[model samples]
Target chain A: MSAQGQELQRQGLERPGLQLQAQVARSDFVLDVHIAQPRGRVLAIVGPNGSGKSSLLQVVAGLVSSAQGIVVVDGDTWMNEDTFTSAEKRSVGMVFQDYLLFPHLSVQENISFGLRSRGSSRAHARATTADWLGRFGIAHLAERKPRQLSGGQSQRVALARALVTQPAVLLLDEPLAALDAQTRVSVRAEMRSHLSQFCGVTLLVTHDPIEAMVLADDICVLDQGSVVQCGTVADVTRHPATEYVAKLMGLNLVSGIATAGTVALDSGGQLVTTNSDLTGAVLATLRPSAIAVHRQPPQSSARNAWEGVIRDMEHLGDRVRLDMEARPSVVVDVTSQSVVELGLQPGQQVWLSVKATEIDVFKAHDEA
Target chain B: MTTAATRSPRRSRRSKPPWVLAIPAIIALAFLLIPLAGLLMATPWTSVGELLIDPVTQQALRLSLATSLLAAGCALILGVPLAWVLARVQFPGRPLVRALVLLPLVLPPVVGGTALLTALGRRGIVGAPLESLFGITLPFTPAAVVIAETFVALPFLVLSVEGALRAMDTRYEEAAVTLGASRMRVFWRITVPLMAPAVVAGTTLAWARALGEFGATITFAGNFPGRTQTVPLAVYTLLETNREAAIALSVVLLAVCVLVLVILREQWLRPGALRS
Candidate 1:
């Protein structure tokens, strides 16, 4: 450790990662969150619209002055009660949602803007910018303006512009949300590779679960200005904490009281799970694909069964998702061939059944 | 065929403006154009070259161009920062300051000259200390002409630039800052480039306004031939003694104003030109 790191440790503030505790109050919303992630890890902040996910990123980047927080990155304090570094002074880089590239500048000038503004010589800035342009496979586009570039090309330019500064903390807000579906797939793969090579701590704010799952190492679920859950991808995907997270993960979550092998669901239903040791308050998550739909009551070995009305049906490429209105409403996915065979339509009555072993049960948070 | 069918309604809608509006609009157009037509018709075209080469005409034209250009340059330097402050900063009494800055636009030019006199004249408030301290006299000089022109023309630049600054997307500046660009860098490299079209439009308007200034120049900077006399003041003076020269100068002023409007129409006034 360096002398500064030792001094930080002496002050009980040394941490080899990003530590942020922020509270921002507005007229209509208040965002309060505390997050810590190790260096070189990409933490994805996932939330619905107006969930303060972007506000958290802005606070960490020193763009929100009304926020009261302590942001320390790799043992360097960027913000504290007495010391508040502005965005320009902090070693941070951000790619905005719309990719706000300077429209007046060419791609080369746009990429070199950070270095030039920080007092780099013209030749030095040009050399570094050219290196980044070549690295991003956009060397031929160096003379083109932003408007002339495609959405995917613009995103790459924005990423290269942000990365060329070699910032200690990189903030990307909806990095791939602006691309079309066809472009998103290819760009997402490229983004994953670039993020894997990045040595800085990254905070990616996105609403898409697939983006989080494919890009980030851990996920932070935010709802209404508060973090509902924060954990690894596998843990959060297998066990979501709130209805929002459950819906985002495509699971039917139910609150219940567990005893032995049975759960008395709060939504006027009973669920039998294979977790025999679980007791007290718990959440049972059932994957949509795990539930089987039938025209008549199943006589098979499936344990839990319920009668439901098909409220709506949506086609998902090769599969069909049915919104079943049962005692505890749930979503079920079946093959399109099965849907055609059964002739499933809205307002049709059906039987839904799932195996006890397929239902994952876990203890709910005490406050929840 | 589909394109024509889809565009027919819009074409018909444009072809038939309401009669109530069309009548008054045509009348207004004729009302503005008739005088320009009369000026071109009444000018002594055969003697125009001789009159334009006269030493008095040359001096007045040179002085007018020099003063107006200097005034526009000064307005560009001072007014853009003022506009930036009005559009970006949040300070007490800013609205009042903006109103005061725009006061010269509506105030009579003679009244503006009088106001400038009270502040900068030799016998006036600050002028007394200025003379005692620096041995300077501002009134009835070429410097006074530029000052008066800048005073009356600055608001034109400020209003347009401030409007453009307000309409600009500040996200670009924020993005620059996050990329480690300082506030000054962002202003020069991002905000200014983004608002370039408006700046050009505003500077042109201010230059044209300064070029045509008569009441203020006559009042503050006394009309002395070849020294303080601009084209407009010279035209006023020559109308009594040399009617043909006055007509030729009026034609020159008319041609310059028309050229300014044409350039504005082609470049900055178009809808698409202002946008990125």
Candidate 2:
């Protein structure tokens, strides 16, 4: 570690990383959140539209002055009741959702804007900007204006511009959401590598679960401007707190009460799971691909089976997803060949079976 | 696709515009153009060179160019910050302030000069103190001409710049602030550069309006040849005694107005021009 890093570590022994507790009240919506993350960790805020994910990021970056609460980053107080630092005074770097690069400036000029604004000498700023351009692998685009660049190139330039300042906190709001699918894949991988190398606190706001899973160390789920669940990515994906999260994670969630190895589903069905130690209230989730669909009732060794008419059928690339309206509604995914052989269609009666080991059960908490 | 492509031209040709609209449009065009045609016809084209080089004509053109350019400079310096405040700041009674800034656009130029006289004339409200404190007199001078021109031309620049500022995307400014740029730095490095086209358009408009100012100059500065008289005032003065010189000067002013229009069209009125 460098001397500054060592000094930060010494100061962080008492108060590490980031602690933010803020409430921003607009006319129609209110965002109240409390988040804490250790240094050198990435926290992904995932939620549906209008769930205050971006609002929370803005509050932390000091872009919203109406936010009332405390924000501490690396043992420094950025906002509180009596003192609210403006965004310009705070050491923060943010990539806005649209990659709002300066349209009139060349790529090199845009990257060096922050350094020049902070009173650095022109030669020093130019050298630093050149280093960032080389690091981001966009040195050839240094002379081009923003309009001449593609979406992926713009994203790279925006990232290079934000990171060239070397702020303590890096906030990315849907950084890859603007690119096309093919470009997004490559840019996302590049972003992951860069983010891994950054020695700072990162807060990523995205609605894509795959992005959150691949990029974030921890997941924070928000719904209706409030935190629904906060845990490690594995913990949150394995056991979701709400139906939204379960659907986002591509799982079928059923709420019920457990006794022994059986769970009395609240939606009027019984699910047998391998978690025999669970008692009282619990939430059980099973992957759609794990559930097998049958045209006729079979004497299979599966622990649970139910008969229902197919409510809807959706084609998803190589597989077809069927929504079955059974005692406890469930989604089942089957191969397209199987779908063709069985001639599955809406209103067709089908049998769904899942082995007991496929159902993951956990204790239920208060609803989000 | 081939049939549709072949049929499109005939289909468009068959859709002729209504005679009701075309007849009045032609009449309106003639009504606006006939006076310019008459002026071109009445000019003594053979002696136009001699008339243009006359002492009075030369003096008026020089003073007009110098004062109008100076007035444009003054407008740019004062109007841009006023426009920024009007567009970005959210103080109370902002609409009222904006209305007051734009009042000179609709008020008569002579009335604007009268207003300037009350406020800035010698022995006037603020002018009395200026004279006693600084030993300066502003009425009937070249400086008074510039002051008068700026008073009438300022509204054009302010209105144009304010509209552009409001239409600009503020996300770039927010991004700059997050990148550790102070508000002043952002204004200079980002906002000013982004609104460059509007600033250019506004300054040109102010310069043109200042060049054509006549009533305000005569009322506030008094028509002193070579000192306070601009092209428009020169044409008015020569109209009674020297009709041919007056016609020649009017033609020059007409040519300048056409040139301004051409420049504006090239910069902003192109079919698919992108301002920023």
Candidate 3:
């Protein structure tokens, strides 16, 4: 295949997929988004709490009608202000965070439920269920009730049940959020594999950065019901459009205190900034690595430094994290080499320093 | 050693029970179980078989079974929908409607029978028109038997199924809905199947209530030998004529109740039993 053809195939757009542009207002939040996924590509929506991610999914699936705007999938209008199709009429599949398996149905029965609705014969539904169960490696669990299955097994069954109907689009709402940390790692990987192999557009929503980075071909960052950023994983990681996204992606953010050229730490204290023209309390963010820890008050031209004690220390891979209870109790990241060099330990005294220019400040919104 | 010492000290204090807590539980158990035991002990065992085999008794038993079963079946058909509407949908007077469904359950059975008679009897406000238009009278017939039993038993099924529906995770229905299944399909294929155990349990309880129906059946359908006299009515009539026969009939009813209870225990009450 040519490069363009390869790219098109990767997007899985044998037919055009969904295009949704809608706005719904709450007393305190406004949901504004315009997004489209190529026929079979996976679009991951990432956001903090109250970001309207689930509402967007509900609108597209026709569970909730949008106050205004359109939801078109594969050239069919599922939801428009003038026309609203019920959720039942939409060929969309959802995998809820809790799995939502029918407690009374066996694994096989759950998988065959949607198939049976499509006028398929019992035997045919059973056959389809058997095929799906086998494909998902849940055939052995076919006769067991949902309550009997482990979390991972039930998750696979739920996925198989959603996929058995061959829906045109799939929506997964924080699919791995209910699992334990250990189970989430494996289940997320398995779900990612299943999603990638399936030939349908999938939209996965999560607040977990690792899940979005691993599973989504493209990421849409929603903040307080609005799309703050939309791009590939690399683009979102390299350049976040909102303070929430920056914090979610593990950036240490602070905001300017006022016109005094000093940015206030989120906890307390203030840092003199290099940007003299920036007024108001602006959001400031920096990588943890950008801040360095010193055992004693070190003479440095960096200009921003505070003396404090190491409140805590945690091991993250090859690095050691030091929580310094300085003016603002800032977290400083350093190599194990530096930990050994500075003899860093919890309760050890330390001084923290950061370059004034390393801080990036932007105006913070007073209202959501 | 430290964990064990700390746990045992806490366990010792926890194991000591208050007389105040034990008194109510003991009284509650006795209050519930004593009547059942008395019913069993007072049964005239010697004549029980003969009383059960009497033609009149047999007829009453059969009528009771047929009417109660029919009523329970009807309740299943209508009550499930009522439950779904009450549990899942929002509308004006929803709370009032839910309370109204339980009206028959809490109202005296005689009042319920009277209510049914006034609503559907030959000279009833609506029934008068129905009678004039269709030349049909619904009182004192087998149909009346079914209606009376349904009136008394439907609330049981509705309450049980409604509780199950309310407790159910609605996300499953949403999942099925998004899977291209219509609302009706989701109800039948997902919601109903998930609630099968509660439905079955409710049906059995409703059937039992209908079988023992006395006041409503006697008032609405009358104590006709084969048409309306259920087990409870038969026992009442025999009590007037023959005390031993009445006691024997009670034993038979007791045996059936015990059998139903056993079935319930095995099928619905057992821990870890699969509902599907």
Candidate 4:
């Protein structure tokens, strides 16, 4: 194969990028999103509650009409002011949050629904449905009803139904939100591997940061019906554009004084961070897992150490959360085994230690 | 021993007569069934075979069956579309239109007979034009019997079907639309199937109403034997001549109605067909 062909085969997609801009007015707010993604790439939309992530995904898939703007995919204008394509006509496949498999139809028949809509004859549609079932490893479930299947199995059937028509763009809305936590992890990994091999523009909407980080090639953070930030995972983790995003990343974020190389705290303290280049008031973030708790002040080269009383204790599976009364409040995660070893309990005194390199500093914005 | 002793007071507080709620339900059942029981008890069993075999009575029963079945079919064909409109469509006077549909249901059957006559009588307003244009006279005929039955029975079908359509989720229709089916196709394939139980129930009720139509048929068609005198009219005419025969005919009507109700309850009120 030629270089371009090889690249196309490797990426599993080679088409023109999709361009979309929309302004949709709802009862409470207006959702405005502008996005562009190359073919074969997956873009994840992540946001907190009440963000218009699902609405934006629906607009791009032509399930809903926008009040303004257009969606152009692969050189074809799917929607515009004067002209619009219906959901069935647009080559966009959507996996709904609830995975609305037709209750009256069997798994095989459900998979054949979109293919039949595309004008395939019954015999041809049957062959295609069988092939998709085989591809999803659900051939044995061809005759089963959706209500009879496990959550993961039903999700796979939903995916098979969406992809049977070979749509040019795929939309998944909280696809794994219905699964149990253990199943979510394994199913999400399988979904990521399957999606990576798809030769179309894929958009996944989720509130789970882990799902977004694991599944998306690029992340778009949405808040209150607007795109707050859009970048690669590394860029977003290094610099979250909104307070919601920072909280979703589970960073112990504090905004206060930063002068020279050490930043002073609002509750009276100073700590060193990796961002020595910053010289003004800044926001600092560090993960709870990155901090270490000590019995006494250890003679380490780490720049962050403070005495604090444990305010709360929470047991989360194998780990325990220790909420300490440090400056601006400090939270640390320790293994349950270590909690037993250290005899950590609520109201106990301890020394909290964090490395300077682990602290990430950014210019503090008053609003966020 | 202490725990067992402590439980008696709590158990006493929990004890309430569970049958207290059945009192009103038992009274309602008696109110509905006592009249039918009275008719059954008064039936002259010795004369029932003779009454049923009477030539005029047999002719009226056949005509009643023919015209009521035809009327019910007509109601099904026209009423379902009207019900769909009233339930699903939006218009300025929708509530008013819905109320108008139920007018015949509440209007005295004799009043409905007069209304049908004014609309379809040979010298009546629109009927006059129809007669002049087509050389047709609709009054005092079997056709008039069918018209009167339809007039009184159509509201049952429409009301039942409209309630079903209103309760159905429109999301299924949208899903069908997204699956590339046109609106008409969706209605025929999805909406109709989902509303089948209601349609069947409404059809049976309307047919029963049409079979027993008396006032409208007597006023509109003027009680012609073998043409407009159905079973109900036949029973009324026989009351003056032979009270035992009339009582026997009432028993037949009651049996037929009870049988229909039992069949419908068994078929449509079961697990799969219980539509909201």
Give the chain B TM-score for each candidate.
Answer: 0.90, 0.90, 0.85, 0.85
The local lDDT score (0 to 100) that residue A120 gets in candidate 2 is: 82
- A1-368, model 1: which lDDT tens digit per residue? 44643444334355677888777775577877878888798999998888888888898888888887778888777877777888898888788889999999999999999888777899999999999888889999999999999999999999999999898888999999999986886687678778888998999999988778777889999887788899987567655665567568676667688999899999888988898987887767788899999899999899999999998777656767787789668878788999999999999999999999999776653221
Preferred candidate (DockQ higher): 2 or 3: 2
For candidate 3, lDDT tens digit of each residue in A168-244? 88888888888887676567657766887888789999998767766788999987778888998755654556546
Off by over 4 Å in 1: A1-15, A118-124, A251-368, B1-14, B132-135, B271-276
Could you say which candidate leads in lDDT?
1
- Please, what is the whole-model Cα lDDT of each candidate in the order they appear? 0.86, 0.85, 0.78, 0.79
List ranges where model 2 is wrong by over 4 Å. Answer: A1-15, A118-121, A251-368, B1-10, B13-15, B130-135, B266-276
Error of 1 at B15 (Å): 2.2
Q: Looking at every candidate separately, what fraction of the true A–B Cα contacts under 8 Å does it contain?
A: 0.89, 0.89, 0.83, 0.23
DockQ for candidate 2? 0.62
Model 1 interface CAPRI class: medium
TM-score, candidate number 3: 0.73
lDDT, candidate 3, residue B82?
Answer: 90
- Model 3 segments beyond 4 Å from truth? A1-15, A83-91, A112-135, A164-167, A251-368, B1-17, B20-28, B119-122, B127-142, B266-276
lDDT of 3 at A105: 75
